[model samples]
Target: MGVGVFGRNHARVYQELERQGEAVRLVGVVDSDLDRADAVAREFGCRAFGSIEQMLTTHSEVRAASVAAPTVHHLEVARALMQKGVDVLIEKPLAASLAEADELVQLAATHKRIAQAGHLERFNPAVRATIPLLTQPMFFEVHRLSVFTPRSLDVDVVLDLMIHDLDIVLSFANSPVKEVRAVGLPILSGKVDIANVRLEFESGCVANFTASRVSTERVRKLRFFQPQQYVSVDYGRQEVLVFTVGGDGATSGAPTVNPQIKVAKPTVTSEEPLHAELKSFLQAVRQRSTPVVPLEDGRRSLALALDIVAAIREHGKKVGLAGLAKAKS
Candidate 1:
């Protein structure tokens, strides 16, 4: 409902869908700030409202809406929408706390509303192609870094950035986390700006993740090793590369770099992830089915992110960072 950075993208995609002949319409834009709402609505050629109630009242034809408010307000906004029979796509990190996440999950169920979580990476073409190739991922190494921006400083690097990789790794691992070890520092923001985490899963899978918002360059890539093969995914490029070990039995599919190694790249139908995500959400809404990324999935990812944050805090305390942050603040 809010027309901030990410919210504007949602509105843009909806408007694009209308122009592309999709059975969808961008009814209106809503924000607590009336001026911002009016600006975005004027840009999109739609009406503007100062609150969800106003938008819902003015645009009764809106069957679905995106809850793009900040994390703390997710439950409040989504709950209001679901209660009024409007399906919602809530932005990631689901909520500021697990209790709030659980409440939204229950509320969605209670209202029988089609609720989805905005885990945009799940819609990436590379990730979609790699899903079927998964056999048994043993280890993962992921890096997501970006130059510092004032936006989303409400959350640490783990929630703001690494949660995308966390959701992917969790899906691939398909097991509960057994242990978490993490370390992070506040370089540019009060929240952790750079973090490194190691997660051990019950299935004996290990994942190491590094996320930074204070970087000189931008990077978004993930590489994982499994039995007899290794797979690499480039989120920015929307590509997947598979390196397989060849046995003496066969080698007819891909080019062989050596007698025992074959490298293959899966064909990726490149599309903007956010566009694909919103399209998928609409499809789910029309079909009355579960979305590719559901509320439970968001909650699971949030749980892991919160645990990693807790680990970071505990580690920081052991090293006197708690006092350091307090003193600085």
Candidate 2:
């Protein structure tokens, strides 16, 4: 709805879909900033509105819409749309708080709306390919780092960056979290800019996640081990490599273990995750079915991220980081 950075991309993709003869259409763009909205509308060849109410009032044909506004405005925007009988695709970290997330879930149910969560990584080909190979995952090591960016500093790294991995791991573990240990620091922002988290699941699965917005390099990768097998996924590369034990692993051309290990790469059709996500959302809208990533899934990830944030706070308090934070500020 809001034509900010991410919202603009959403508009662009919707426009692309229209050009491709999809059953969807990009009716208009909405932003509180008139100039920004007008600019995006001009770029996408659509009308601009100052608010969601204005858009809905003018364009009643908009059966579905995307809520790409900031995290804080998710509930208000999505609720307004759902109230007006429009399905919506809300951006990640479903809401700022669990109560708001619950409100969204209830609103969707009450309105009979097809609500989708914009967990972009779920559509990543690498992640999709790694799904079927899942077993009793015992351990995980994940790293997501990026150079310092001023965007998304409104939230901590746990929500802004690490939540993607959190959702994926939670789905893989398929068990309740037993314990959480986390520590983070505000490197270049008031909120936690870098974090390390350890999660233990009830099924004896342990996962370690490290996320940073202040880093020298950019890396997005997840590796896990289960039952004498290890799988690695590179989100950026859209690639997956699996290592299986007790096989003819002597093939030296691929990513493999020793002679006793076998390496295989699942077939992954590379495509931009955002495009895939939007296409899937539109398909769900047309079919009147559930989305791949629903509001409940988003809430699950949000709850875990919130827990890690709480753990970070507890660790900070124990280490006397409050004074350090105050002094730094």
Candidate 3:
């Protein structure tokens, strides 16, 4: 219901889906800034409203919506929609805090609403392609970097970027987190702009994550090791590469430098992740089924992200970063 950068993209995709005859319509766009909302609605040929209440009052037929509002207003916006019998696809990080996330889960249950978490990576073709290759993932090295932008500065790097990988790894490991160690620093904003985290799962799996919003180059890649396979997923390129050990190289047919290693690039059907995510959300709303990425999974990721943020704060206090910065300033 927000017409900001991410919300605008949602609106555009909805319009695209309608053009492609998806049995959906872009009824309207909402934003605190009326000008922004008006612009987006004009571009998508829909109505514009200044508030969720205004839009809901004007259009009672909006059975489902994408809540791209700021993290802080997630509960407020989603509550208004859900209470009115509208399904929702809430953007990532779910809510600003764990309490809010829990409340969202409860609200969905109480209202019997079809709700989905907006973890775009879960819909990425590369990630989907890598799902079948999962087998005792023991270690992971993931990186998500982007050039500095003023957008999404309201939250730390953990929520802004790392949470995506957190969701993925949490699903892959399928075990409780045993330990969390994290360090972060504010580079371009008051909130953390870069962070590195180490997580150990109860299943004896470990994952290292580095996320930065300030970078010279953009990179979105995840590499992991399983029992006999190492899989690499490039989110930006929408590709999956698998390397199997001591297996006949029948998948790729390309001669490997090591005869013992066989490489296979899984076929990934290219589609905009947002397109797939929204389509799934609509299907869930229509059939009253569980969304692929549900509120529970979102809450799980948010819980871990909050723990990492707390760890980062603890490390900063231990190293006297606050005092050092005060002295420098």
Candidate 4:
């Protein structure tokens, strides 16, 4: 079942798959908006529930669910579904707070249900290709700046955009965070719409991240400096450029360090990451296999994002205006 506002996409994708006789089917939908529920139901020829309880009660064959509600509702919906012995795949940011995310993780464990988080970038072919080249990354930088959109006006840029980079960074290491420095500003919106974060890891890895929703052009890029090699990833263009430091075509047998050279600029085909993400979620449920991005992973990412937000808020003290209330004022 697809629950809540943005979840309509989930139902549509399922219906498309069923049209092609795919393994998944559009069993039901649950949305807070009655008109939307009814319209979507008519389009897909599926039942529309006013609440998750009504959906679960009516669809006994619904062994799995995809939770696409707002970030705040993620925990509530996921916990309820897991309690009903249904595997759940939740959208990004996991939950509004880490504490709530942790509760969902615990619920999944107690109920023994497969719980996955929607960090769809994992399915991006560019990201998948860069994963192997990320070995021994000493320095990483990510920037996700896009033209302002009101679709996610409830929160700031960190959770809205940078969480993708945060999730991707964590996958590269097992080291704990040593320190974090951040700052944010609210230009047009009541909340912080742009932010920058610098993270230092215990293993000497450093990552600089920036996100903004008030940009003239859309950009999604990540650059990594791993040892003597440098890799630049342009996710939006689905292209990767790598540079490495090694010996040149010289007869000087002194093994002298050579200038950096451009490595293969691999061409990555463009594909919809969300479709692959949902497909994997269904496959995981069917095979009883571990989720590619598990609930615990979501919990950890939310925890880090919360920590970054706190640091940015505290960062105001450095500029002598400690309590600048921009949002919820």
Candidate 5:
């Protein structure tokens, strides 16, 4: 795997897995910035390429790629790799638009190679713990707020931060979104840095989500309520709080006892999900099995994200937010 854009982190993760006798190796590092390239390559004892073309031309053993390039460059770079028979695990949001995502998905299908999305939350232990519990969610609520970070300004909060929640919500419901409503404004940044969205799903599940890159504190959580219980999960803290009826007569109608709250600390192991995700992709390639987060899933998330962005724009117009600054003000 070639570390693209500060992708030495990918190299580190893979090397750590290799140290554990896992099936991953550090092939090389690639960067348009020669200095960054040389620095990371020297540290990893691997070759460095200033361009994807050079990497493809020079390294024949490079079978797969983890695309950590910027969003705008994702489609172009990943498509080229796919054309060359290299599977790609692209960073989240897939691409800037649904159209681009579609193209990449088709290319992967055409080539019969892997095209996985880096929605690392799919592998998150917190999410994995909650997946089985979310059988029939009546209502879902998510909050993903962080003290303003300098990363991911190429797009707004919807695409940058909120899409993670959106993807998770969609995955749980496994239903089509019926309607979307959103409000966003550029605060602290010259783009839509913060936003709130509501999504209506056909399965009678409604989701309210709020995301902001401008905040004093950080929080990543999701809450879901059903007929029998309410679940509050702190994804940031890896904590789950389940309030539900207990005892044999619990489901006998008369609300048996207080809601049982279980705090299941999942044996804090050093199993990084991103590393697991990357390993899964590699294993899929080696086994010719399906990737956990396939390209189609990424496409669906991108499509919904674009709809939310459009809804926010419409909200802007409704409130007479004709200018970006006015919306923020």
Candidate 6:
């Protein structure tokens, strides 16, 4: 609803879908800043409003909306929409806290509204391709790095970046986290700019994640090891490379580095993840079916991200990071 950076993208995708003759229409865009909302509305040929109240009142026909407002405002915005019988696709880090997330769950249940979580990576072709290859992931190494940006400074790297990988790993592992250890530092913003986390799941799966907003080059990759297979997923490139041991390597069309090892690239249909996610949300709203990435999944990921943040803070205290920063200053 709020036409900020991510919100603008959501608006654009909705407009594109409308152009493609999707059964949906781009009714309007909303933002706290009226000027920004007006600009986006003009660009997308829709109406604009300064607040959810104004938008909902003006567009009572609005059946569904995307809540791309600030993380702290998610519950408020989604609550208003859901109460009005509007389904919602809420962005990641679903709510500011667990209590708010729980309330969102309850509200959706009470209203019988279709709610989806905006975990964009789940719609990535690479991630989709890796799903079938999942056997029993024992270890994982994930990296999501980007050039520094002032956007999303309201949260630390754990929430801003690492949460994507967290959601993916959590879904892949399908197990409760047994332990978490993390360390992070604020390089350019008051919030954490870089973080490294180790998560051990109840299924004996260990995952190491490194997420940074301050990096020289961008990298988004996840590599995991299963029983006799290793899979690599490139989020940006939308590619999946699977290496299996003791296979014929005949069907893969990829050269075998070793005689016993086989490499196969799963076929992935390239499509904008936002487009796919929105399409899925709309389908769920139409058929009264559960969304692929539901609000419960968002809450689960948010819980883990919050836990990692807490672990990082504890580690900082143990290592006297405050003293080190003071000395350097």
Candidate 4 global TM-score: 0.91
Q: Write the per-residue lDDT of candidate 4 for residues 71-190, one digit (tens) a residue.
A: 778888888888889999899989887678878888988998888999988888888888777669889889999998776878777888888999988887568888999988876676
Pairs in steric clash, model 1:
none
- Model 4's C-alpha root-mean-square deviation from the true structure amounts to 2.8
Clashes (backbone N, CA, C under 3 Å), per candidate, total: 0, 0, 0, 0, 0, 0
lDDT of 2 by residue, 266-287 (tens): 9999998999999999999889
Worst window of 10 by summed lDDT in candidate 3: 320-329
Residue runs of model 2 more than 4 Å from their true location after superposition: 247-259, 323-329
Tens digits of per-residue lDDT, candidate 3, 61-128, equal 88999999889999999999999999999999999989999999999999999999999999999999
**For candidate 3, what is the lDDT?**
0.91
CA RMSD, predictions in order: 3.1, 3.7, 3.9, 2.8, 2.7, 3.9
**lDDT (Cα, 0-100) at 36 in candidate 4:** 76
TM-score of each: 0.95, 0.94, 0.94, 0.91, 0.92, 0.94
Backbone clashes in model 6, listed as residue pairs: none
- Residue 98, candidate 1: Cα error in Å is 0.5
Deviating ranges (above 4 Å) for candidate 4: 1-5, 248-260, 321-329
Question: Candidates' lDDT values, in order?
Answer: 0.91, 0.91, 0.91, 0.81, 0.81, 0.91
Which lDDT tens digits does candidate 6 get at residues 268-295? Answer: 9999999999999999999999999999
Residue-wise lDDT of candidate 1 within 248-318, one digit each (tens)? 53345555455577899999999999999999999999999999999999999999998888888888888
Q: What lDDT, from 0 to 1, does candidate 1 have?
A: 0.91
Which residues of candidate 1, in runs, are more than 4 Å off?
Answer: 249-258, 322-329
